[model samples]
Target chain A: MSRPKRQLMMGNQACVQGALRAGLRFYAGYPITPSTEVTEGCARELPKTGGRFLQMEDEIGAISAVVGASVAGVKAMTATSGPGYSLMVENIGYAYMIEAPCVIVNVQRGGPSTGLPTKTSQSDTMQTRWGPHGDYTAIAVAPSTVADTVTETIRAFNLAERFRTPVTILLDEVIGHMQEMISLPEPGEYQVVDRVKPTCPPEEYEPYGSTDNFVNPMPAYGDGYRWYATGLTHDAMGFPTNRPDEIVVNLDKLRRKIEDFRDEICKVRADWMDDAEFALVSYGSVSRTALLATKLAREAGVKVGCLQLQTVWPFPLAQLRELLQDCTAVIVAELNMGQIVREVERVAPPQARVHSLLRYDGEILTPIQFLEKIEEVRS
Target chain B: MTTTAESVAEQRRSDVHLSYLRPHKKFPNLWCPGCGNGIVMSSLVRAIDKLGLPRDEVALVSGIGCSSRMPVYLDFQALHTTHGRALAFATGVKFARPDLKVIVITGDGDALSIGGNHLIHACRRNIDITTILINNYIYGMTGGQVSPTTPSGAYATTTPFGNTEKHFEPCDLAKGAGATFVARTTVYHTPQMDRVLADAIAHHGFSFVEVLSNCHTYFGRLNRLGSATALLQMFKEKTTSVGKTEESANGKIPIGVLHRDLETTELCDEYQKIVDSLSKGKQG
Candidate 1:
């Protein structure tokens, strides 16, 4: 392959490049702080590629339009911050129920409502998992660097299409706005997954019927295989059903589609854990601090390692359990008040004590602060 | 004693039945016997049939209301979306695939109350989609609540003491919001409803058609508008055609094509121009 072209890119711009590479042809978003650059980049680049970008009236409309475009057989996406993400939760649930393949990028800002629009926080960690009401599984990924933003976004869209559901890319303001120099991936360096289309004739097509892999092939509108799509609980034929047996079967399929493939869906990166007594578990922008803290501690004759979670949901519990087996303790670091730490506490081995290092003052956790917390947690 | 013309009429009726409707789904829709929603649905189907578009090429989208359920019985690519958000979804569909003929079916409350922002923006954008707003003057699906188009002093379940708010004129709202085409007709005016719907569909930009329908089971019973038949009679008597160019002495509202602007560029087409220009700049 020819030499990869190098470019200085913001994290949000990297996300747009990744989406374009993943076949994103439509974007509908309402501008919000710390996340507006993603929309702006899409507005400038998507049209140049013959793709469409729309600034919706509100975040709800943004997500609703994204779902609609996905149903119409276009790879689509939207970006927003905390306040807009709150408005998008309803349609996010709708996309899940209808099994539409789409991606939602939440560059999280602090708050219950419109808090710290310009600052970064990882407060949406839990909300990304259970924001929409009901018993359903979610797939979310976090990127620690501008380059990872591009790769993770491509992975986000791939996972959405693979599972036939909406995927969330959980970003924080730091990663979304921070500038970094990186080389764009050469063509064919990364794999792109498209939604599987039906091979059966129109008369025999069932939009919701399970395939061998449990994911149903999606047929877009205006295709010869026209079908009804709704947020209602539906049967194999894609028609609404209230039958008790059908409801169980339908809901169970939605859960199992992601859970059954957890091995392939979950991802994490472990560094320098070969001979450590303690480790730092981190994700998103906080992982950068954790990495630097580990390096400083290791040089000073302290045995410390870092585990960065790239895929936040499906929790990567088994991987965490295995990685923490030899360690005596694990420090969970994040920008929020002990969100993912709770998950670490739940999944860490019984012999490993779990502690949290949280910083939620609209400031990123620094390496010095993390090193200090490591000493305190170890003591 | 059957003539050739009668035979031809019979054949046309059968052709419409076999061509447009889903036969397997239970006969007679879930609407009430005298509900004007059925009349509106028939008019829509007839309009599409008259346009001669393939069923696969037409996608009908609707929100949560009595009128929104019209898509379920028709054989088209249909999406029954969330309450008050059908226009937003249809906008996405049209933008993604401008080749498809997109149509939205909504009601007064669904379009003017909870979904008011989307409705006005849709008109303002002038996207190439046809919106049919069914104005029954009450929220029939949710059991006779006061709607934005509910006339002042009207008795609704929520407005037990009579509604105190002024009613909305949907056609005026659409026209004010820059809709390329706007029209109004009633269920009682069957031929006029069909013609207006067809014209709205044929219009190359955003088009809004407000159908003044009746909900005798809710709105009429609460306000004592007699029976469904009496409500239909009232519509027939109270609606004056805009083509007449004279005001009705009985204070009837005008019904007919109220606004049309063929010169303004449609939104999707304008976006395509941007795409083309950007591509040219990149290549150059």
Candidate 2:
């Protein structure tokens, strides 16, 4: 008498299940195509879980409301597509500087301002990194499958809480709306990280003080500790300052905190790269086609492999360097105008050639299309 | 504990300077001398002190502007965010922890201008939080530009020829937007402001306060109220609190508890109740 085995679910539904499992008690969002399903699923499920769901007036309000909810000390999230993601940049910057822990899901769509609302694109890859002004680092995870969507959403929540930073689940339209069979892991199977709580007396705790761990403990409101947080350059006490050296040191620390612990932050999957002449570098739904293309290429004796990225930002360059060092060339396949391909070219060895296979009209690349690029790059 | 009216008054006069004020005087204070933001900041600190909310459990959020800088001077967890979105950040802060007492100190420019949508929806949704909007009738941070509250005839940087645009009566706006607790007070009216703020904090729903402040440098110079004291005098002269049953007339906006409709449901509580029922369903 086994409990119900794995069930078929849409990528958005899986994300909702992930939010529930991760203890996401609040969700604020505006509905847009491709990403609307995530909001719809949350709307139906959050109330059942005693979790809150709000359809804000617009994307800015949605993210803002989530930020407000976050400070009140609940696990909160919001979902949107590319255009909505653009509107959320200001609040995202606020979350970054204030060290507010929350999750945002962007079901990527073709954009430069609503290029194709219903189409898929990875154009937001660079936007997610540089959309907001000012100096800050972001943590974004790209999921390749419906199972990955669920797990990665949970991981995004955990990473956001642990780091006291906003984390983005970089999904595309193809994966977000795709219906797929996935086994839901038991509730206890995955590690769920909660934000660090203040253990010291309110008088002694500085909101941004760095101990050996480089992360400060956060105290939720009404707990009696009074601390200050601001977007401006501040000292350990969270008061604004104009010191140049202090600004430099604080900015450096913000970057180093993530990079210093890169091993814990980065994630990538490799398949059949031991004796490969060509490698297909891909992420999100595009990684699926690359994997299938690799299987076909290998069967055709082309010796191709796939490097699937899970943590897209802080782009696992070191792992990439080691993985592609011996390969003759790397073909990057994505649903956008070759964003990550540039990153691959930048990080790949000087001797290894880099090529991009882009699809911008809101369509997913099929195995044939990916194999064509791999074969062309190999020749 | 419920706070008493007497204690609220005592809180206002209480020495809150040590907790918030910079140890040494910093120059180039943006507010006009004797402007209400300092008083409002003091009132906020005193209210937090009176309630004895754990400092760490409190996160003060503000958007860009003169009043938004209130977070910078406070000792509590604060986020000085972008223009017009303090409510949004405070929303994030509150939803993330729910245990945290989140306070948003925003201004007319930050709240009603760029942040107007966030403000309206936050009130409508009725989340349990407090928003202190300092209404100085002009954008003080950006050299006293016209704001949503600037009187139609008022002059501002953007309205050099006198504003012909309509002004938003904040108290009415909050009440109409379904805020559970809405109040208005001038900084000169310190006792009432402190008491009302504390009540707003304890109200269990979205609480909004329009602290009619003086923008002597901007709104004042244009409107012929030349000094901060003169502006305070004007606030005293213009405002009169209508008791609970009285209908507020045009040009007679009340100075206290404009509306206190407790019937509106709080979003998180409703959400939690649903979770409780579901978990019970699972157990049964």
Candidate 3:
């Protein structure tokens, strides 16, 4: 392996680098603040590698194009902020229905409707899983630091291709714009997964045929296996169908592909959790503050630890319950109006106390504020 | 032993069917009987047959509409995407695999009302994809709602009082949006529709063909336009050749290729040029 090189880079720029390393060859996106850098980086760099980048008319078109490219046998991605993410909900659902593998990055800004373009928020945590209407499984990952952003983006694409589903990377404005020194991974340092292709001849190939693992072999367009793909509920042949049995089988495949492989799909980082009274749960940028807060709390003789979630969706419930079993209380710190805190409360042991430390006023949660919340919850 | 004109025409029709259509998918299509969409589909299939292009190399993409269902009956790499997003998806397919012939089949509302942004932008980019927009003047699949192409004073379910919105001239809109090739034809004129679709598919840049199809189940019944056959006959009488520049009496609509620009660079080619220069610059 080549030596890793240390470079100063923005988190968004690192994401672009990670995408390139993960075999992404097509990028389609529109400019949205806090995430525009990702698009700009791809535009400048993708062509040099013989990959293509398109600045579509809107977020909807951007994601639609990404889905198309993915179906056409290219690893594809798009980046957007809150407003743009909202616009992409329908096509995201379409991707899920059609089982297209692509990565979507939401560098979240505060929003009900373009609420804060330049400020940071983790308000889209729930949106990442539930934004698209219907019964389907979703995978979203969060990265707290610039280095983690690259690694997590690579993981996102791998999971997307392996599972044949859309994967989202949730970044806040803080993580997106913050500059940090990071050691870029050498080639082969991380795993890269491409979708499985069909071994059968063109006549016998089924695009959505089920295997022992839920994912079917995906044939690229013009691969002589010219099968159908649709957003409508479809059969194993990828043709639209309204039959109850076929619909149930199709929807069940989508859910089970990720759910059954939760252990392999979910990633979390634990700090000082072996012997602790208070456990702090956080993700994305807030995890940085939580880490500092845990350090300060330990300095003050308050036995506290942090659980930094890297994979936000697939919930990682089993892991959370196991880790929080010995702790007396768990504090969920996030830069939103208590989104993932509810998940913490739902999964924590019956004896463990659950409290939320939320900051939705367009400001990052400081370590001091986290300490105060810990004190309040402890008392 | 001589063949009559009718017999020769019948023989050609069967040949086109055998060559272009999927044999296993039997005849009664999803469209309502006498729906002009079937005629448009046949014309499209005939166009492909005439070009002698490999079926496996072509991709048919569509959004949700009665007209959009045309792809399931034919044999090609097909994508039935979300409502009103066929062009956007088709853009991706074309960009990724420029060698594959991508054709989009969309209807009035699917192309104009909800998917209008993608339509105009696709035209502006002049991407190398053939788009056949079937303008039935109303939303048929949704049961006769007024659409952007529904003529003013025409009646639809949503426009029971009368449609107050002016209809769009699709060919003009495509030309204004920078489509390299634009044309208009009626489903009644089968030979013209087939010829125009072939030319559009053969164009090296973005091409648009607006087929004035009849939604006999919705638009016709609402407007009291008689039977589907009567409406088709009306199309033949009320439309003038685009070559006849003089306005026919009673405001006859023009039918035929309205615009063509063979010199404009296609989007895919332009993108490739950028990639080439960037790669060369890196090496030098």
Candidate 4:
């Protein structure tokens, strides 16, 4: 039977392959629904690559360990579901505040608390933006297909390394478990990114101070530049302090470093939007439904387009405002109760009405749901 | 092969900070005055110095507490992480780079209360790292809350009327959790503290040190030892040799190297071995 052609894999499995391709050497995570496959996939594959895999006792431990591995100079990652992601917020902030590069894959499930293990939900979209306490910037990507999981996972790591912050590859359980045919090129095809390292002598290195940017090139723990790191609002030297001016400077730098370069980091896919009167805004698995609805709307003699978000954070506000310019109205469809719809409403022109089609029940949004919401909003 | 604590201390004082430590002292160290956290920090720096570990190769992971501030003072790569998860982070750090020396510095409240799960598992897995737990008998940073090591009748901010809970002997707990090397020492005993700290760092597998530190400002005030000198004297009188048999440990808790044995199973070593075997099998 030729071994079934050797290329078909599940989205979770694709994530593991992508992580390996990205040179992820350590994974510490707790198994939760939908996201369990990620840990299982890593457990099955990490042994072949001489990488380390550990089932941490909880989500906090999982992300904390990933941050630690990054500081020690290894590409590291952790995976989790809704509750687990919520538990990981503080440490995620720590990673951003300290400029520790790592990746987190949140295979999102139904929310508030242990809502549903096997089902899918996009409830975490806003949580991903503001989950962690205190203020910082985040780069979050949502993938629609199993293939996109592979590509976005690689990009997630690249963004993390390039910015020296934690990056999230937001996947819904629907995509996480979806089986599809994907051809993964050999390791050389992907451009893997490792964080830039300091070339200065160990004695001359300032762990948090860089001459060119807010981020200092991080030296691996064993590379000889001993630098202090802390979760507290810190000075450039990595020491904890509550000084108001120092906190303002540190916090502003963390937010500005990523926000200033939003044009380079933010990504969105616009389909047939230039002359359309109506637009559908969505991401992750729901974007698939939006595409189907857009096709149906076109057949019904309605000129509609779809904006599929690849990078969900930094909100892609500029692109979104530009996209919504010509549209008479926009329908924002998601699995949650109006999370991204609020952002759409925030960016869309007042004259261009924006409406939401949201679901909190543990079920995928169907094409019919999107069509119904579009018709209701159009009327 | 012979070394004394005094020799180690002198050498450490002159030794340069690890590559991670910057020129000036990191500001706002959370430790209170006359606190023994400084002693523990010095002991660690001394161990790093004596071992001749390249500064950049040593990573110090710490959780929240007074002693958790150790990483900020000494130069070296550090991840001052959340409360109670330092060991878990150190596990990832050590396993990811087995070539580097990974040290976890945690306080009693931080390691034993919220971080309890990580502590036992790290010991059970025998990961190649050293965990230095500073047991000040109370939560120093959060205002003298009763900790896992608070004596049964001792008073604390959280336990104002006096605690009703039983305390854990961290060394015994670590040994029970399968730590390959477990020892107990006090900041007052500088020579023994230095020696035990060095040995713990040198051990191949997971090594745990329960350092009895004095939080004179909080824990001391509650326990009636208001001064640092008084707490040091108390430590001297209370601690006994672990070499004593079970009969001796029956009434008096032995406080030296309570457990030391090597089954020689390290987490990263076993993981790497599995990788090797799998690769070999694939080749065949």
Candidate 5:
């Protein structure tokens, strides 16, 4: 790749760049604090790429439109914050059931309901995966910095198209609004995945037909594959089914299709994990501080390492378990009240003393805080 | 695609309207016998047939309701979405491919109460999607509850003490929200409904057609309105249509096209202009 275009830009603007580079042709979103920049950016940039952008009346309408566009075989996305994300959870479940490919960006602000509007909060960690009521699986990615936001967004689109499911990019106010200097990815720098199209003739095309990869090909609406899509449990023929056997097959496929490729879907990056006795685990903006703590702790003659979890919901359990297997103590740094720390507890070695460095005061955790947690665990 | 029923296939050869339906999926449909939903469905299918739009280019989006079940029985790009969200989804489909004829099938509660915000904004945007709001006055699929359109003093399950709420005139809402084409027709008026719906679909911007359907099982029985046939007869007597009238409908729910503004810009066409201007800007 001829050296990626180096420039400085805000995180939300980079996300739009990534989405446009991945060939997103349709976008519908509502403005919500901390995430409104994403919506505003799409409105400004989408038309430049010959894509259509709409500001919906609410988050429900925005996400509903996004799902509709995806079902119509267009790469689509929407962005919002806490209250809006809650409103969208209903349609998010519908998107999951219908197996539509789209990306949803949630630049989190604090909330059970309209918490801090301008501050960063990772309080929506579990909500992103379980917000929608159902047994359907979810794939979500968390990017730590402004530059990586571009690549992570492209990856989110790829994963959504690959699994034929709606994927989420969990950003917080800090990363979403933070400005950074970096080069944009060159046009062939990253692989882009488009929605799979039917290779068979229209007459034989089954919208939910089982293929070798488990994801059935989906065709654009006007492409002559006039198949059915519904929020109800549907059979392989794309028709709603009450038959227990067909219903089980329908629901099971959603979970199995993504889980089968778990190893490929889950991404965890390890730093200095060769022989560390103390490990710090984190993701998104929190991971940046976690990594800094690991470095400072090493200089201070303490053997500490950091594991950044890029893929939040396929949980990355096996990788976390293996990397933390040798550690005597594990510290989980999060901007929430111990959300992913529970995941760390599940995988930490039995002898490993797990500690949670929690902060949910509408502010991000610092490296000193992580360092303090490790020191406290030692005492 | 589902397997075709042989009998259904045989019936298609006998009737041109049968060709518009799905091969076998929910062949008989789930609506009760003599339900007005069937009549509206027939009228909608006939209008689509008259338009000669290819099934491939047609997308029927519906929310959850008895009336919203219209899409599953038809052979097109059918999407049965969440309750009260059909228009929102159809907006996406229309903007994504303005070439595709996107039509939203919704009911009174689905369109007015829970989905009311979307409907108002959709009309305001003047998006190119034909919305058919089937007003049965009560929620038929769910046990008869007091929907937003349940007439004042009408009895519903939730309104067993008789309704204390005023009702909504759907055509008025459509016109007030800036829909380019707005119409009201009863299921009893099939010829009027078919022609009105066809004209609405032909209109360039957002089109809303209110179909006054009968829910004899709950709405009619609870109100002591006699049988489904009696409700159909009532529609014939209660409504008056004189094409476009500025006068108060003389206390009648006026039928036929209530409002039409063909010159108003459609959302899709305007978006296309923006897209064209940008591409041209890039070239220049």
Candidate 6:
């Protein structure tokens, strides 16, 4: 009934705000630079809402705790930087295999291994999808601004709960620490999805029962479901199975649950190229650079547009291919050394040429930088 | 649903522990025929059966090992997790759902080696979860590799010449890590293990029970320990109950509840108090 409050908050702070808004009841994480604020925020806020927060000894424990908490029927989350994210890949794979819904926020820093802690880099772009081993798909949401971080985080939880899979909120150091004014959404402004519980009685309930959509309702521990969860490939009853037929069924559900409905899962922000000749494709804070560059290109009569990716994983190639259909030249600008550019090259129309604007010095990509790359590739 | 009431009664009378096991799960278990892990698992089942905890209200969590396989056969809300990380997961389960009883089954390598960090931290927090560390002195599942509990001069697949590192006593490690309740027993002492486990579950804080089980197939074959019976005899001769005059003087392993501190607040309860106080503060 009343207008929502507007306040200046860091991107990490907004993430905590968004997680709490989405009914996060459990958080477990270890401290990492550029993402420590997220852990601190949850620690201070979770107990206030009667939710539990824990600072596990290390990243493995942090990720493990989140999966454990999620199984016990709480909306759970964890945040970390590149090093911690590396420690979490194994359990992220575990979470995928068991089909536990949770959110992981990687406020990415420069890295092969801890390249730069305080500086910004999107080097972990590919790691977000492929870090966890085996056959599975991941849903990732990338927010370019502080305010967008809040909504994207809520969406991350929603996607995780919707498909019953772990979703990643990928941010770089620039956005994670950057402060901006965010008008917090009132209740009913943005939808919050709670975990899906089985309607069937505890006895008849099959935790991994097949459905047309490939998603089965999840029941929390101690709710009389007495369901089993294992990292091993499991059958319909949630017990481990090594049979070829059963393993295929277990692996297929993970891929199809998100892939079959990617139209609902992927989000992108595209602008300024109704009849443009050149385009800039980017995500995270680089999209902010791409937006400014497109505006500058338009004023300079350079006929360039920008496509900002809000969701990076599952590639969003189909949507991107459609967006770039009219363009002759595309510049994929990012802080990493051409991570997302590789994906753009695959989707660029056969007649179109995809150019890369890369930065790996742990710094932001500037508008002038993206514009220069566009002009060079155009000529 | 097909199980008849008369058949259920027959099963309960024949083997009470089988009634607690999952009807659909592959049972008789995957442990080797003469494995000490089987005895250890049955003791756990008996302990839970005696405690009268509801099946739906208890969660069995385990890491990868011969001992970790215990959860697969249980009727409880079971979680078969990665190698060496069951305690970390169990901490989350218990912390999030404090009303549910959480138990962790791990082995020497799973708990003390790969998962050592989680084990120590779980003890330090004193969360209301019970951990059963089944020490077989070698990595049985991985085919008898030397483990943290393997003696300095013991033989294993990797330690063909003999193990060179000093062995770890699991109970000592638990106590050092600030576990609120610590106990040690062997498969040979089934009654003591059953009693110790039930008490450990009843304890209001983190309870660590070290179970010295024999890996007759691996550790025994590699070293010259003979049959499962010989290993059981060795346990009887090697261990004595805590605080017995003549037995204590025999320089044997102490088999009993070694340490218990009831005064310290558990992790979940303290966290609840914080949550309660905050809500009260808001109201006032």
After superposing the true interface residues, what Cα RMSD does each candidate give? 1.0, 3.4, 1.2, 1.4, 0.8, 0.8
lDDT by residue (B184-212, candidate 6, tens digit) is 99999998999999999999999999988
Candidate 5 interface CA RMSD, Å:
0.8
DockQ category of candidate 5: medium
Off by over 4 Å in 1: B1-8
Instruction: In angstroms, give how far residue B60 of model 2 lies from its true place.
Output: 3.6
In model 3, how large is the Cα lDDT of residue B104? 98
Off by over 4 Å in 2: A1-4, B1-12, B16-30, B45-59, B74-77, B93-102, B202-204, B243-254
Backbone clash count, each prediction separately: 0, 53, 0, 12, 0, 0
Q: What is the C-alpha RMSD of each candidate to the true structure, in Å?
A: 1.6, 4.2, 1.8, 3.4, 3.8, 3.0
lDDT of 6 by residue, A58-128 (tens): 99999999999999999999999999999999999999989889999999898888779999989888999
Candidate achieving the largest lDDT: 3
Ranking by lDDT: 3, 1, 6, 5, 4, 2
Candidate with more favorable, higher TM-score: 2 or 6: 6
Q: What DockQ values do the models have?
A: 0.77, 0.52, 0.75, 0.72, 0.77, 0.80
Model 2 chain B: ten consecutive residues of lowest lDDT: B19-28
User: Candidate 3 — number of clashing residue pairs?
Assistant: 0
Kindly report the fnat of each predicted structure, to 2 decimals: 0.76, 0.81, 0.75, 0.88, 0.88, 0.84
> Across residues B1-284, which tens digit of lDDT does each residue of candidate 4 receive?
54698888766665543432446774545567778988888778777777887776777889988788787777677778888888877887887788988889998888888999999999888988899999889987878899999999899998989999999888888889999999999988888888898899999999999988888999888878769999999888877777877776556556777678876678888888898999999999
DockQ of 3: 0.75
Q: Which of 5 and 6 is ahead in lDDT?
A: 6
Give the lDDT of residue A326 in candidate 4.
81
Query: A48-129 in candidate 1: lDDT tens per residue?
Result: 8999999999999999899889998899999999889889998899898989999999998989788998888999999999
Clashing pairs in 5: none
Q: Mind giving the per-residue lDDT tens digits that candidate 3 earns over B108-128?
A: 999998999999999999999
Candidate 6: residue A135 Cα off by (Å):
1.3
